[model samples]
Target: MTSDTAATAATPAAAKSPRALARARRRHSAVRFWRAYRTHKAGLIGLGTLVVIALAALFAPLLVGADAQSVTDAPGEAMRAPTGEFPLGTDQFGRDLLALLVWGARISLTVGLLAAFLSVAIGTVVGITAGHFRGWYATVIMRVTDWFLVMPTLVLAIALASVMDRSLWTIVVAIGVTTWPTTARLVRAQTLAVESRPYIERAQALGGGHGHIMTRHVLPNVMPLVLAQTTLVISSAILTEATLAFLGLGDPTVVSWGGLLQDAREAGAVSAGDWWYLAPPGIAIAVVALAFTLCGRAVESVLNPRLGVTR
Candidate 1:
């Protein structure tokens, strides 16, 4: 009888293990989303393109022996069509277009990544506090966000970057500071939804502090939204950097896409039928941005099935 009872108890515990695993499997739906996303052709291509661009930008010097900033011409190398020496071609200034494009990835990636990180950091804190706390803190945070939202992000960045000697760091800070409102609003909505969930309420009732509730209970749920927003914002930041460079506010010191375009314009590449100068950087920007955008759209579809999901 003792052995029978022990066996029966052990069976229930063993059965409960399966049930617990099933529940955990259901709770983390990210795996399902990834599995679904993998089947998406655009998602896979965009991901691949992004990886290639990141790698090229990171290892431009190693990948291409030609200096991105150096205007080199071997007389034979001058304005050469896409050949072994210049896979992409040479610029109007006789600079290696391929080298410029490869190096420009560094600037785009830097601006995008740094700005996105800053926006997320500031937005997450303000958003969590505002939504979870729900008081003057919330009001103040939202109102400040409102003020930022009203300001023209690109225009503001132009003004700020222009005034600060037009350095890479200046552009990074300017873009980061101006482009956080969208993230804050998105995160705040997610935080609010998370705070009202049954688990969150239960945590609160179980003597969890506000900080503990926000960090432990709320953060995990809202992270998906943050991640989705990150890809999209990085795309926007890259474009913004290009725009700054186009408008003569780009760092002349670096061979970024914007600077490449600027050099083309100055050298009259388009007017002179040297489409080589204008096309490469434009294509580079479009390619990188398109990759991010495609991935963002796919992630958005998964994260927020309906527009009402507020991720």
Candidate 2:
């Protein structure tokens, strides 16, 4: 009995607790994901670009003082050509264009990330619910989703922004609520595919409730799709915010890429032949959008190998 007890005690902790095993699986999955992600050159480039841009935005205060935005504390003469004193030159307000660009990145990226998160959260919930349930409930949810999907997202966002207060959060909400329909549709399709799997059926047969089935079985499977979609959504959100700002709906108190363009237009940069004022913001927007697109495509390709054939 003593020997048997000793042998039993020597056994390796019953193959680790469920929590430890889950953590190990997660670590393994992360390794695999990184291995696949790094192989895509475009994705790596995009990620590096974003990292640099994000770091700059995060450290904007240290790079340039807040006085850079102050008209009274202008750093250089207005509309001066690029030189050693001001690489990007000064805007009509005599604020440093370089400083504006740096600060603008902070606002643009914040709006993009927050708006995308809100959009994804709403879409994921609505989609999973609609896909999991049946009968009139599912029909109603899908009809609502279809209605939003059919309407022009930009128009809806414009209308919402028009009616609401002009602030950063207002823009975030306007973009988020209007943009969710696409994500909802994508997630619903993915959810339906996941629900059709044998494991889901087994889960249901084993007395798993709706919450259990959806959260445990369905959500994990669809998360990769959500992640990829989120990156794409962020690009769209940034573009939308820029559009609204350019249309004179942005908060006047803040500096954003879109606001810079608006200021240039109002300041007659075009008539004055000031390309520096127009080019920097435009190029920044395009580059950031392209970076997000590349990253999204890479993630999508990694998750669905069939799509990577062309790449």
Tell me, by lDDT, which candidate is best.
2
Clashes of 2: 0
Highest-scoring model, TM-score: 2
TM-score of each: 0.84, 0.94
Candidate 2: misplaced stretches above 4 Å? Answer: 1-10, 13-15
lDDT of 2 by residue, 159-182 (tens): 999999999999999999988988
lDDT of 1 by residue, 102-194 (tens): 888888789778977887778888888889888888888899999999989998998888789878888888888889888889888988887
lDDT of each: 0.81, 0.91
TM-score of 1: 0.84
